[model samples]
Target: MDEVLNFIIAAYPDDTLKELIQIKLSLDKTGTVQVSVSNAGPPVHLDRIPRFEPSAPTESNLDGLWYFLAKNFVDHLEFRNLGMDGWQAVLERRLSAASFEPRKADSEGSIDEEIAQFEVRPGRHDDAAELVDLTYDTYGYSYTGPDFYHPSNLSHHLASGEIVSIVATADGVIVGNTSISYPPETPCCAYLGALMVKRSYRRSKAIELMISETVAPAIGNRP
Candidate 1:
């Protein structure tokens, strides 16, 4: 029971546990366990809720218990700044195995001239709000993931140098953005995330331009 509570706290760090109206846990003699939680808040919209399908636990399931819990019960789950060493190692190993190899860049002189119409550069602290607005424009409010969608969170990441962002602006309006974040403990690796482009410009080769002009240069500068 304590383990389950700890797992909940770890998975939903942003939620207030005190607001939960009820929590029920049941474990049978066969080792099958069930948990139900009710929180005092606005009723959850059905479309927003994640459906859970029961699966018998097996030894071959490499993802820890938290994975199942999050997939079954939560809208989203993120494991950041949680001091669970073992879980972090498992997550890192899984991510590293699936990581893409950084691509090489072409010489500037050989690149497409059309890319010059859009400015591609490293993002600044002041760009956080614009970045969030770009995200909303791209994915809408229902988008839930690890990307920092708020200016304050983005600012914290930028200040810490944990993330390096690249933005593409056309005539002073941001139309595209992407970021690569370094895991503090992983010196040789970085995770690329939050790649987005306004719908009208999706076919403009903006992503390729950002990768060539921004991502490649930034990654090369890393020690």
Candidate 2:
């Protein structure tokens, strides 16, 4: 993820003062993994999404050499223009052989009812404990990110301007969280960080709102 993001940042023009970037990782029951990167700079037309035949892996000087090497391994790669929304590149790969049952359709509308009450806001110092607990509950120590395992570390990072966290709460309890980080070398770019929602709140808009309504808008307002 870091390698791909850095390459994307390098492609941006040097004069831009601000940028909005989003990365989404999705996994389906059939075990296909998709990584999407979107930027709020320009809309790339659908016709511009690469459609060239695969070439043998070889040395090249193209700016998109990383894309070439990656496209060779991933099952699918495509780009899309989102009009007013921005541009996106999606890469997909199948990783699992076993399939699981799909989620049940929302017939009773309970999922909507539950998410309607979520409150999104920037995270605070006091939110550290709950954030760490939530991470543990979700990943059971298997999560590779070490900072999330320590509340003090999270608080420190939040204080040092290393990250900005947007959290979704229900009745004042954090139910979902996401973050944004600006790479020092890329002043015009910001990277989307990890997003996690409580098991019970996974079906809600808590994740979406944290990114779209809170985090992105907050970064846009930065000086």
Candidate 3:
């Protein structure tokens, strides 16, 4: 059951609702396994319904696994467990089936070549439409969050200075994005979230660039 436990841990890295979620796994004398997930948190909002449906044990249903954890849990998700071949196979199959077009590494030569064509800078209100499209392309309808996925909502957040968004543009097209959310009560601390890069650019140092160039500057500028 270590694999199952690892899956859960990898699925829900953020403890945002950790204390509110409980997981139970049981195996009877007959060897039948049962898994249960319960939410003890406050009532879920109408627009933010959970999207996870448990998959049958016999099949390695990667799409079901990702839908449950990524779409149902939160808008932004990342996984670093590179050694899990099973999970990786699932991702490859799913992305191919969905016709997800990520940047082609073979055509781009080296990582440096790819990074050279991309530019990262503070996001503008005009970027709201492209950013919304990027989120929709990445997460689809599963991400119902109004903050970043909606153009008007993103513009409001940007205008109010509640969120500092950094956008990556390749050939004048928005391809990668990340943001830092500042809590009004905690002046010194900022929550870095909404990090996403187009599948094609993921092989490059885009994330590192966002952290070092955009996120760091925003946090340092906070008073």
lDDT of candidates 1 onward, in order = 0.59, 0.71, 0.58
Candidate 2 lDDT over 1-223, as tens digits, reads: 5545665676677646446788899887778989999976654443443443345433333444556566677899777778777777888899857567766543433456453698888877678889898887667888666777888988876766666778889888998888666545776877676678777677777877887765354453453
Q: By summed lDDT, which 10 consecutive residues of candidate 3 come out lowest?
A: 86-95
How much is 124 displaced in model 1, in angstroms?
0.9
Report the C-alpha lDDT of model 3 over 1-223, residue by residue, as the tens digit.
2332444455553567433435555444443444444442332232343333475432444434544554343332332222322122111111223332445554364345444577888887778888888877656766545676779988877766777788878889887888777766886787777677766666777777877776363343554
lDDT of 1: 0.59
- In candidate 1, residue 99 scores what lDDT? 31
> What's the count of clashing pairs in each model shown?
0, 0, 1
Candidate 1 lDDT, tens digit per residue, 1-223? 3433454444443566443435555444444444554443333233433333347555554335544565445333332222221122111111213333444432322324465478887887778888888888788875454455778878778767777888888878888888877778996888777578876677677888887866464452564
Off by over 4 Å in 2: 1-116, 183-189, 214-217, 220-223
The true-versus-predicted C-alpha distance at residue 89 of model 3, in Å, is 36
| Cα TM-score per model | 0.45, 0.44, 0.45
Error of 3 at 114 (Å): 4.2
Task: List candidate 1 segments past 4 Å from native.
Answer: 1-116, 141-147, 214-220
